[model samples]
Target: MTSPQPTPAPGRVGSAIGWSYVVTAGRIGSSVIVTFLLAKLLGPSEFGLLAMATVFILFAQTLIQQGLVAAIVQRDKLTAEHLDAAFVVLVLAGLGVGLLTAAVSPLWALINRAPDLTEVCLALSPLVLVQGLSIVPEAILRRELQFRSIAIRTLLASVLSGVVGLALALGGAGIWALVGQQLVNAVAGLVVLWLVCPWRPSRRPKLGAIRELWAFSAHAANAGLGSLISSKADILFTGIFFGPVATGIYRLAARLPDMLVDVTVRSIQQVSLSSLSRLQQDRARFAAHLVQLQHLGAVAGLPVLGVLAATARPLVEFLGPQWAGTEIPLQLLCVFGAVNVFGVLLGPALQAIGQPGKLAAILWSRGLLGVATLAAVGALITSDDPVGQATAVAVAGIAIQLTVNAASIWVTVHRVARASIGRFLAPTGPAVLAALAASLVPFATDRLGVDELGPLARLLVVGAAAGLVAAAVLWSTDRPLRQLVTPRLMRLRRTRAATGTPAGAHSVEASATRSTEK
Candidate 1:
């Protein structure tokens, strides 16, 4: 048997992270625009209906993707036969999920006590199919580290989706406007992926060739179930106990933190999975990379989560008066956000080290804890007060989830990555302390006199002040962050000198690295 040759360690991690930031910024900007317009056009009830529809669509989409894309990305070798079989399986699964969603829409509406939810779910069913088709092509781009292309495609889709949704809502389409927006985004994304990705299905499927792939994907499916539960448990609980209006508030409140976490941590995971997969056989190199990633997670995540936690009230109030109830839930969720960043990074590390089952184990434990916490909280809160119930449930679940996720990542880092406890805790502990100190600026300001400021002005002041303080603190105390951010800045200077396009330098470097490796 021939040993797997070591894959090249492309210098694209930084570039990938940059592209992710740019893409995330564009999406966030577009989201803010769409959200403001939607809130003006639609009332809380309509927004709630749209939020509920999205939860169902997201749940189905998660199941259909099932981490198979990551599995494919981590593989040492890729072939046309493998991509074909994966696509075939995904399409079949998408069809099944779509059918199941349609079949169960009425049941869901009945259970949730929302008669209109059935129509909303039925309207959103095609999204599952669209997402399933898009997954493989997007995975192919990610596997090849074509983040620039991915970023461009995502920006276009976000723009189109937002524009269409806003137009429809202004034209009095109500919740259907939201549904149409999602379908448009999905279809547009699939079209872009098909156009940008060069891969095409072969003439025939090779079932035997994909069996090992399925073995990997089966474990991924287990992990993905846990991931889905972790991601959606709060929304599900809110919808069940607090109703659609409360869910809408929770959804919007959680949006900023979720976007930041996903953009920062998941972007790293994308590059890490491909990069670390290349270093799988070198235990020393793999361990070193894991350490660097742990620090990276803390340096990037802690301050962001802290700032959000500190300024959540102002942020929520500024968004709208209806959003004020979201403050506590958003703050409590920041702890989970910080812990989840580490857990997410570790899962990719396990997969890169050829331990997909370990990732599955960790996620399963997390999901179980999350569900139990939610159930217990629900049992305790029988009140008709939606915001109160939602707050209690969110606080309890996030606390349990933070504990469970932290323990899981620690174990994975120690057992799978073979790192010591001290090493594991060192970077994160200090970063958290530094973040807390930096976060106090906003908290103290809110306590002192800033409370009198109007919500909009207060939110802007707190957000800007918190950002500047956090950056200064991070640059002063966090050497790793300085190192990481500094090199990229220098590279921009060099690229500007050479090509006179500082903006395009990172993407150019990324493309060059991928080409050299190929």
Candidate 2:
């Protein structure tokens, strides 16, 4: 991957972020709708079986597209030859994974002792090939920073696929409903991506371009493996020992907090890596970007996760009373997800700066530690207590995630940016206090004999108070929070003067200049 010669313009950066939020918002809205419907329609056992099948599919997905997609996004120059080569790689990998998935489904089913997994895996095999066909087109758009088209396509696919999934579940298709959703999402997403970014490849595969991508791909392959472990190893462990019911409950436990953190982090991530790659040669600009992203992301992220953790009871119940069994696990996952989000940008930052090997190491360390901890904890759970096992996993997960993320952030900030960890995490201090302050509302409200209040009411009280406390703390403690809108306002003034042409549309450069001048 070559370096982006020029830093992305501020207008472009702002536009990218704005469109990314839309993409997230659209997907989230549809996902919430789909999840709620699925939770209501499917029982725990059925969902658990589906979850187990998904681990295999996701593993296949990681191999088929993730490494190549990341390489494409990071590559500074894109040739038809390069894209053609990527498409060829994806096709071969997808075909191999699909056949391998079909071959191993029965063995996985035997291990999990879920006969349904064998069939579900077979049904999902075609998706591997279908999605492989989609990656290059999607990467082409992403590398060009064409997020609006991506957002519209995603939103449309999500809504359409969600409708199909909901209908299937309601019609008593059970586990197949979830399977149907995956299939629909893939087909719909691919179609829309192709429609919007319709550039057909004319060149045959170029070995030279493929070799260049391998420069990024080799380390990226490790990072992808680590990601697979970090994301799915728990589900794998749960399915192996506890059965579909437990795995389903674990899925429910993890769903919301993961959604919240993922949505919040992705809003920045869609632009951060690609945009930041260009400015890496300018250390001052790069450091300033890292500082602002970490601080702002924490200020927003901490309170959301904190509130969710503290109020997991109502949130779990909000899904349905049948899901009450997952309350504690949900709480644990909320906290775990909250702590882990701090390091989300670190791996991306390293990869963007041409240190994919370093990122692979960090991700591998975390993934391995997580898997080991899950195994050790699994060995200790001899009782038939699924919730208890989940609780143990959650606790270990939080501790491990926090430790790894904190250490990784420290190393990345100090080594790469020459910035202190204190500066990196400074925003968290007040954010924590705000979260603590927010927790008090629920405590006080419960004391007021409103324990019978609906989950929504309790959530509103706690969430609103948390939002206020977070704002107050950031406003009081973080200077950047005070002028959050100043840049946009300045840009608006400049835009008016220029009659709507962008004025120095590189936000990081502008922000860095301001910091240095001060």
Candidate 3:
């Protein structure tokens, strides 16, 4: 048996999370600008065509990565041969998947009854190969906790790709503009990843080095595929039943909540896999970090989602009249996003503890349930109204999320991690309560004629009010959170003060005072 892995230092973990947040923040910011510009320049049918083609690309991506990233990061020992083997396997898989995607593009379009999607899929096929080349290198970076480099790659790619997409949109390239964005993003990321990741594949790479990794990666891949299918099932069903226009609208609505999760929950989840994997042998430390990360994720993520749900109408309105059908779905999805934040750590934590099979089983079960419920909704709802159909889909989605995700959390915390259910859930209670409290701020303000202020103004006022309310509630109820955030606040204050810049001294003092009360 191999020796236990060393636990990651707190500072290292914090830095990783910090950089990952930067990556996600930049990505979301660039994407929002690109999305807004493209929405005006293109129509629903155009976006729908791209969305239809992307489902296939996403599946191909799962096969190419095959959970090798987690396997690489979670492994107790590393070898040069392992990296070479993974790189070779993935590159070949990328080429094969790309070719296969191109070959099947026509058939996929026929199935969806959208002839335009054929060229779209063909255009995106090369992206499968381009992205595949970067997998092992990116994995290596994550394993080494080199998130700063990853952040740089992500930010640069998002901006450049967004620029390319917007330029094409402005030039009236329509759907191809969206297509170009995807291709550029993948290529840019691949180039930057190779530059930062110094390891290169050997000339005589051997598959034998991956034999051990396969045992881990196989289950990780299954878990990943299942999770992907579960998340994408609604869109797939929407595309199949409602066609491209509805699919485009639904996709855009779903993207908002998904982006919100990416901002904090998903970033923390990515860092948790690497950090938790390092602490696997230290059960006490592993448990501590696991719970702390979960608590922090909920504290930071759920409230934002809650505010989004409460203020979704104004948020969606900002996208213009073409996006009229988005508000209801966006609100429902925000709830799903909030619940999803709680479960984000489950897969990474399980994989880190060498229980990827458990994660796979849970995810697959959830996927099947999600698919079945969505199919039922599709069959029962005879409404030709794409917006109504999409709304029903969103409702079913959140219901599935609430049931499966809650149970999965209980299983991960109480059964696998050996913590009490209450201990696992206690941190989230304050967050949930705070979210409800924050949401009420919007409800009350809206009742008091906040709608008269216009969408943008209402959004700003509601967002600010909800955020402040959530922060106050969380600060009052959660002692550990105050302890966790106070030092960071103080450090920020000291930096700004020393630099002769303005800072929120009162907020820092309040947090500091609350932390001491613990």
Top candidate, metric lDDT = 3
Q: Name the better of 2 and 3 by TM-score.
A: 3
Q: After superposition, how far is residue 284 of candidate 1 from its true place, in Å?
A: 1.7
The digit string of per-residue lDDT tens for model 1 on 280-392 reads: 88877777777776676677678877777777877767666655577877776776676677666777788888888877777777777878888777777878765676578
lDDT of 3 by residue, 231-298 (tens): 88887888877888788888887887888889878878878888888767777767777877877788
Q: Tell me which of candidates 1 and 2 scores higher on lDDT.
A: 2
Over the stretch 1-518, how does candidate 2's per-residue lDDT look in tens digits?
A: 23344667766766776677678878987897689779977777877888899888888887877577778888777677888888888888889888998999899899988887899999988888887898888877877778889998999989999999999988989888898998898889888888999678765567567887787887888788887787677888888877887788888788777777666776677777877787777877787787777665676667777777667767667777667668788877877776766877887788777777887888788788888888887787887876776676678788888878877887688887777778777756766666556555667667776568787787666566656765676567666655764775677687868786565454433443333223
Strongest candidate by TM-score:
3
- How far does residue 223 in candidate 3 sit from its true spot (Å)? 1.6
CA lDDT scores, all candidates in order:
0.75, 0.77, 0.83
Report the error of model 3 at residue 160, Å: 0.5
Lowest-sum lDDT 10-residue window in model 2: 509-518
RMSD of 1: 3.6
Model 1: lowest-lDDT 10 consecutive positions: 509-518
| Count of backbone clashes, every candidate in sequence | 0, 6, 0
